[model samples]
Target: MIKTASKRYINNFKGFSREIWILAIVTLINRAGTMVLPFLSKYLKEDLHFSLGEVGWIMVSFGCGSMLGSWLGGKLADKVGFYKIMIFSLFTSGLMFFGLQYITSFWGLCFGMFAIMTVADMFRPAMFVSVGAYATPETRTRAMTLIRLAVNLGFGLGPAVGGLIIMAIGYKGLFWVDGATCITAIVIFWIMVKEKTKSPYIDKKHPDEILTHSVLHDKPFWIFLFTCFATAMIFFQLFTTLPLYHHDQFGLTEFQTGLFMTTNGVMIFFLEMPLVSVFERKNVHKVKIILAGSILMAVAFFVLMLDFWIGSLIISLLLLTVGEMFAFPFSNAFAIGRAPKGHEGRYMALYTMSFSLAHITSSKIGMEIIDRFGYRANWLFMGILGIIAALAALYLYNFLHREPKKT
Candidate 1:
């Protein structure tokens, strides 16, 4: 039975092309080296002596840069191919990281972070485009799962090592390692993957029947994008208000809070790909799956409203993790599936941009709710947002099914 389970787990990772594997490896390398972000706020506050408000502005600048980068990456990928954008983003961002450590002044650091993030985040949509180009329709969701697993694994590894580096060589070492990793990941990618001007793989099943002529006109996709946005807002609570709630309410130490997040990462690494495989194998509609995830996430928040019990936190986290496992990979695949040939970069950019925008707003909104109405209010608010997202997904599912398929 153990052997059977192991074989099934391994099989889920099979059938991916060599390029997909290479891309995953590069992503893993880059993400693992991403030790700078988690510590950025602390570094700015403690090391640079920046005030809290100043740090907030810098972070807002960073978000703005990220949003612009995402849009540019998508637009440029369609114009010049994903290969060039990926290479340029990584290489330039690496150099920027090395210099960012030198910018100690508030304004200098703010501009530096904005510029670096603008260049760095361009890689996201381009990489999504690359995944679509590399994987088939049947395997695309799983392929995205592989990429997410790599990301989770990298995030899991990055912080522990980053802490050690900070203790040994200080924050400067983090900058060096982060920069080096970006450059190293891209170098390996350049060596392993040959650049192509066009998508090598084609979806022969729907060659002429793209859902909409222009992305702007894709009404169902707009609803789908809102679903993505709402889900992200709820998820970002894990990083933002949820941590504070753990500390203030349950008396969880930073270390204990870290463990809760680790649980999330570990679950995603081990379970997400296989779960996606199961859903794909069953021929489940992506929007239906997403709607289910939305409900789960809503319930996860509502579970937290049971503040009388500490175990509610664990249960809520598990539900949230499973919901994330359901929503994110399929969302990626659905976004790609919606795009017409040669327009995938644009579609993916918009999808990624939603997350970026959510990251900017989720913390502010959650924190305000906590300040004004308390943690229970925040949970209720998030739960309601999740339900709204689920409703949007349901609407999208019905909308797509009702649209006449053009053969």
Candidate 2:
């Protein structure tokens, strides 16, 4: 039985195109070097001695930069191509990371964070569009999950290694490593993947593809974006407040905090792909799965309200990781699946923008609430947002099923 299960799991990874595999490899390399972000808030607060409010503002700037980058990357990918955008974004952003460590003042760092993210986040939409181009509709969701698995694997390694680097050489070393990794990943990508103007895969027509109106006319898509934004806000707390809570509540060191985060990454890495494959194979409704994931996230936050035991932290993170495994891959597939043939970049950009916009507010609002009320208030607020998102998703599920089909 165990061997049978293992064989089934391995089979899920089969049938992907060569381009998809190369994209996953490039993603793994880049993400593995992403040690800076998970620890950025702690570095600002503890190392730079920035107040909570100032840290929030700096993060807001970072989000704004990400927002602009997503827009530009999407627009340019449509005009220029995903290949050029991916290479340019990574290489330029890598150079910026090396310079960012030199800035210390609040304004300087704020500007630095924003500028670097503007360049760095351009990779997201381009990468998403590339996945769409490379994978056929039948295998697209699994291909996406494979890429996500790479991301989580990198995240798993990044934090644990970053923690050791901080212990050995301080935060400055993280920037250098991050910069180097970005350049390395792009160079590898350039060598391995030749540029292509159009996708070789032919998309089969489906009823869902009938709603190919301009995105502005799609009320369900807008509602779906809002749901994504809310959940993203809740998720971004991992970088913002959750790390601080690990320290303040449990007196955990950076290494210990990193271990907790590593658990999240590892769980997602191992479980998300197979689980998403199962869901895709079963033809489960996307919004129903997303709503279930949202409810789990809200429960995870509420679990944090039981602050006495450190075990609650573990339990809460477990719930959150499982929720992520369910929500994100389906979300990726849904957004890309809904795009019209020529407007893929635009659709992906809007989808990514929801998370970018969430990043802008999640940190600032979370920090402010922590300052004025406390962590409990922030947790409660996040939980409420999760519930709202889940309700929205539920509505979307009903709306999509009930709406008249386009002939």
Candidate 3:
């Protein structure tokens, strides 16, 4: 039984090509080095002497840059190609990370944060483009799952390592170490990946068919994008709100909070890829899975609302992890399917922008709820929003599958 299980696990990785593996490795390296943002809130509040309100504004600045950067990244990737843009985002972002350590004033930190995130966030759509460039539609979603798996593997490690770094040399060292990894990943990617003029692995489309595909006119894609935005707004509260909530209410240390994040990564790492494969093989509707994920997300917040205990938080994280494993990956598949070949970057960019928009609002909105109404209200609000997002996803599914009128 053990050998058979191991064989199946190995078989699951069979269809992917060398470039996909390289992209996954690059993601793994970069994600492993992503040690700054998880600790940024506590660093701002405790070390820099910023209040929660101030931190919220700082995050808003970061988000503002993220939105602009996402749009620009998508546009540029479509124009110049993913390889050039990705290398730029990685190299410049590493430098920005090194710059972050020097900013002490509130406004200075905000500006610095904005620069780092803007550069860093450009990598998202570019990475998605790279995956689309490499994989077949039948295998594309699984390829995406592999990339996410790499990220989660690194994510699981990053915070645990970050916790140690914070204890050893404080928050500044976290930035330096993270900066080093970003540069390292850039070097590896450049050396390993050769841009194909035309990929033989995936089927090709007629030039004219691609020439006309524009994301701006695609209504169903917009519906999916809005659904993504709503889901992200609720899900990202884990980043913007949960850390402080744990610290303030449960007295969990940075290491302890890191454990929660590690748990999230661990669950996704072990389960998401296989689960996605199984469900896809069964011909399960993507939107229905996403709706289930949404409900699970709601349940996660519901757990948080029900109790202040660490155990409750753990249960919530478990549920939220399941939700993320389901909802997030399929969103990409749906968007990529909507794009024509030439416009993959733009479709992905617009898709990436949805999450960036979420970042823009979630921090300020979450902080306001916590400060004015309290943390309980914040969780309840997130739960309610999750339900609404689920309904939106259901509607989008029906919209996409609706029968066309014969002209």
Candidate 4:
């Protein structure tokens, strides 16, 4: 019995051993460098004295560029190696970070943000592809959970550190610090992270194989994509609408809102893997878990709309974090599971694109709704959409789990 237990422990370690650590480190470094978004609007508004409208435009430009970048990166990863694409992305993004110091006008800020988001987004698909490649079916979910943990931990620490740095030196100091960290990550990737063998779906003789088979050729994949896109629209709203809700309704300060966001990252950092283990052992279907999480998330959003007394915002955030912990990593694993072996980069790229599309759509739509109807009305709309997405996810999960016919 002891020998059997020892062997089981060894197998578990072997599942994640070194490659996962390398990927985790890369995630940490990237997140640490890019965690200044919480303070970015403040810097633009107060330091540079940009109007709120101008800042909004700048953000839209970055999102547009990111959408283009994610698509291009996926295509490039299929042609060039994932490692090469990641290296190029990191270096270029680092350069863009350094260039932020020179932005004087609205156009200059827009251009700088565009360049930075484009290059930064390029690293995303490649990183997802690399993780898919490194992990096996049995361990892939846990591996992704670990990656999420690393990301949340990095994000949690990074903003706190960046906040302090901005308080001390200023926004320029934050930009320089982020730029230096990006360069450091690039160096680390160069020295330590090694690419494994390419997927069988990719052709060694002809790299153009990826372009030949369109992602739309698969029907189920499209269904999954739509589900992701819808869900993300609701998910991304948290960043924009939630804080405003708390501020207007509860009179919470920006610092308090930041604390609420940090709590999300903290929960994921500590609980994601354990949650994964628990859910996986339940023999529950992956899609059911996803559906449940989505419903919970939507409910959490709806709960926030209630005119509760003080501290209710914190409770709502906790509920949303719990739901997010289940949904996000599951989405990653499910997408990877559905991917054709060679087209991992393309699949993951498409998945990430859902996020970009959602952010763009949500910001535009949510803002317009907020303009017409107050924050409460806008959130009600989002909550309704979230419910629709949950129902759709459940239907898709059922469809995907249906039995295949014998030859």
lDDT of each: 0.91, 0.87, 0.82, 0.76
Q: 36-117 in candidate 4: lDDT tens per residue?
A: 6768888888988999999889888889889878987887877786888888998878877888877779998898888788
Q: Summarize candidate 3's per-residue lDDT along 190-276 as a digit string, tens digits.
A: 998898533443334422122234677766677778878878888898877999998998898978987787788777876888888
Sort by lDDT, best first: 1, 2, 3, 4
Question: Which of the two, 2 or 3, has more TM-score?
Answer: 2
> TM-scores across all candidates?
0.98, 0.89, 0.87, 0.88
Please write out the lDDT profile of model 1 over residues 1-407, one tens digit for every residue: 99999999999999998999999999999999999999999999999889999999999999999999999999899999999999999999999899988989988987888899999999999999999888876688899999998888898889889999999999999999999999999999999999876665545466423657778898888899999999999999999999999989988899999999989998888889889989988988889899999999999999999998999999999999999999999999888878887788898899999999999999999999999999999999999999999999988887887887521
Give candidate 3's error at residue 181 in angstroms: 1.6
Clashing residue pairs for model 1: none
Q: What are the per-residue Cα lDDT tens digits for candidate 2 across 246-311?
A: 999989997898788778877876688789878878889888889999999999999999989899
Q: Which stretches of candidate 2 lie over 4 Å from their true place?
A: 39-55, 102-108, 163-172, 200-204, 246-257, 308-311, 404-407
| Best prediction by lDDT | 1
Model 4: CA > 4 A from native? 1-14, 199-213, 402-407
Off by over 4 Å in 1: 207-209
Count backbone overlaps in model 4. 0
